[model samples]
Target: MVTWQNIDTVMLDMDGTLLDLHFDNHFWLEHVPLRFAEKNGLTLEQAKETLMKRYRKAEGTLDWYCVDYWTEQLGLDIEMLKQEVDHLIAVFPYVVDFLDAVRSKNKRIVLVTNAHGKALKIKMDRTRLGGHFDRLICSHDLGLPKEDLSFWGELQTIEPFSKQTTLFIDDSLPVLRSAHAYGIANLLAVIKPDSKAPAKDVGEFKAIQSFRQIIPA
Candidate 1:
């Protein structure tokens, strides 16, 4: 059983955890490339391949999230492109129930995401998630990736926290592992990417298909 003792601070991932990731997947893997290709007069496949390479090479760095990076490479106003599909930004099923339960318990919920500031803003606007979190800590603002232990160290300087008394929930294994390495006592990995997926693996930290499983009823 996962204990919630002394867990005053709760850190959560946005995409795939609190929100549906299919939208982001579609945007990056399909929509954006198609739009870019059309705008640049390039083939869709060619545009996707080129953009994918640049993004992959930028992994773990701020440039990975920079709108300017994509704008320069794809020649599209990334922000405007985001606005085109803004309707897709949506909360996952059961996310609000979970958030409500946590709030009812009076826990200090903080949104800790590796998502870029601009993207975060876009998501918050769509989902109104900012109203739920005590603090929205973006990795980009800290100039470090959440998957790095040094980022946690820097976080400590900004806001002191006890790893042993905090709970962190994320969808990515690498990010979860990083949190564990940083000594966060309680970590929950959301399995199935989408909670609706059937017959998925039991998550690493008290595997859950829905947040309602962990948040006290």
Candidate 2:
């Protein structure tokens, strides 16, 4: 159980933590490939093979989350493509209640995400969860991805969180590790970021199946 008294800041991630990751997974893995195959006169398999190779090369970098980078690299209109399947964007179960619980406790709630500005705008508009956060920060503005240790210090400049009294939750182990290395006292992970996929093995960290499991007391 979390000791509510010690946690004054609740930092959260976007895609997999507050909202469903299935939309992003489908958009990148299936939707984008289908569009690429159709646009480039290649078979779907060929397109996927081509894109996946490029994606692997940029996986942990800021470029991996930049829509403009993907658009330029793939020669696709990523913003337009995201709209093509905006219907897939959705918030996870009990996320609103979880946010409300934080507000009720009067703790600072912030969203720190690596999602591109366009992508973040699209999801926030689609789900309308923007108002729940006290601050919404995108890594693009920081010039560093959360996987980098320096990102924590950069984030502190704007959000002013204390490592000892803040709780950071995310679906990515690398990001959690980044926070851990920065001396963040509380760290949590999500096991099933994409409801359609199997639970991930978040080694050496406490985890939850849903935000419901950690709703503020």
| Models, CA RMSD each | 2.2, 0.7
Q: Give the TM-score of candidate 1.
A: 0.91
lDDT of 2 by residue, 39-154 (tens): 99999999999999999999999999999999999899999999999999989999999999989999999999999999999998899999999999999999999999999999
The residue ranges of model 2 lying beyond 4 angstroms of the native Cα positions read none
Over 4 Å off, model 1: 194-205
Among the numbered candidates, top lDDT falls to: 2
- Tens digits of per-residue lDDT for model 1 on 1-217? 4576567778899988888787777788888989978987889999889888977998767676677677776777888888889897778777888788788888888898888778898999888879988889888778888878788888888767889888888887777887888898888887766533443454466666777677665
lDDT of 2: 0.93
Please name the candidate that would achieve the greatest TM-score relative to the true structure.
2
Per-residue error for 91 in candidate 2, Å, reads 0.7
Local distance difference test scores for all models: 0.80, 0.93
Model 2: colliding residue pairs:
none
TM-score each candidate: 0.91, 0.98
